[model samples]
Target: MTVKQPDLSFTQNPQWIAERETHWGPIEGFLKENNRKEVVEQLKKLFFTGVIDNPEDVREGFAILYYPLQTAEAWDYLFQDVRLNPKCFKEFMNASLMGSYNEKFFLDDEARLRFFDYFHPATYQPVIKSRVPIGREQKIVQIEVDRFEILRDMAAKFSQFLGGSEVPVIYYRLDYFFSFLDEACDVMDVSNNDKDDIQYFANNFLQRYFKIESDLEPKNRGEQKAFLVRFYNHIANNPVHPSIKAIWQKVLDEHD
Candidate 1:
């Protein structure tokens, strides 16, 4: 069954001023800036409401209006080391919110679904609508479930951020991960290796990247195999949208 995408509509919504003020403090001076206000209005219209109608139009609008603000430093830091920080997830959410706000203002269901397809917002939302009540407000399972949700959100957002870029440096970093993994495997093989060493290395790498704690043990061989199968299966279930792939190919070309 297909999942329904959220509608966008944030741009030009006068309510955004109050909404932003709650998080960012007083916005009198901010709202006073004509250019900034216009940008914010545009952001609300296109991002929040799905008014733009097409990803190509969105890309072009971004380039013409927003690209100057997107510095090389921002791109490099974002694609290279910035993704390692979980704090950036909030910014992504903010951007997504802005897009949806705009989309809702200017676009319809079909257009909104297209925008959702472009953004993959579902990957970042909470797993469940409400927690399953256990007893007396302890919520031990709820807390654990929430924590895992955060991790999954981070993983999905990180993948989207990297995958969303049209910058060469970004593609190089992703390609390097695959190459680095292959090279690391070859170098660490001892041939006399109990094979446990290979598992240890892979586990260690994932642990560090995923911020797994010291107490957690690597899954057994069968569990590990199942995980690999499930991860690939998940990828297969959700095909990458073509617009994103085109952006990636453009980045790859610059590298070549």
Candidate 2:
């Protein structure tokens, strides 16, 4: 059975936005004095509701427009270290400034997906909706569902099961645990409230391996292999996603 993908799709091509006359690309092209008015006119009610394969090119000649200041900052942060949801974008558009530097951009299903894809930063988190209210009178507003942070928290929770300490230990033992973690987080079903349970498992795992610790320290290759072997079997014997299981298999294959 094929999983239905969520909308808000677009091809990621940095070519158009790259090597422009400026570092910010030709972002200012939409704000040209004589051209901006015509550009705004192209933004009909359904402006972003259509598919865009070549995000590098202007749509029917309409360059991507931004509210200038806050919008640019928001997009910078969105695709940068910080992640903001569509509500923040909607709010900026609501109280947009008088000049072109205002962030008055709105997103429909198609444009929202593509826009994020094109300007994607490593931290960008988007929530693609498969179903929404069907109506003519109701307005459709885009909402971003950012689980990236939560997923990291969940990964931390699992990491703690191998440690009596916090996140740094995960990085310390990333080699043994990365595949286990990459697969675990990809499942996306765990919660961040697994601290007590994690401690219980950590104690059991440490004592079983006779590596009892006051604070978790580095594990030797043998100890690491012991845990990964069980982890590999756990995935194989259980009902797991094929994609995740496949990735988990590589760690076992390569490590041996």
Best by lDDT: 2
**lDDT by candidate, in order shown:** 0.31, 0.35
Per-residue lDDT over 125-192 for candidate 1, one digit per residue giving the tens place of the 0 to 100 score: 33221121212232212111132222233234333332322112112223322222222222223552
Candidate 2 segments whose C-alpha is farther than 4 A from its true place: 1-25, 28-64, 69-137, 141-242
lDDT minimum window of 10 residues, candidate 2: 93-102
Model 2: how far residue 172 lies from native, Å: 20
lDDT of 2 by residue, 34-141 (tens): 444544344321233323333333332222243111233323332222222334344322222111222234322333333433322233235332122212222234
TM-score of each: 0.19, 0.22
Candidate 1 residue 95 Cα shift, in angstroms, is 15
Give the range of the ten consecutive residues with the poorest summed lDDT in model 1.
Answer: 127-136
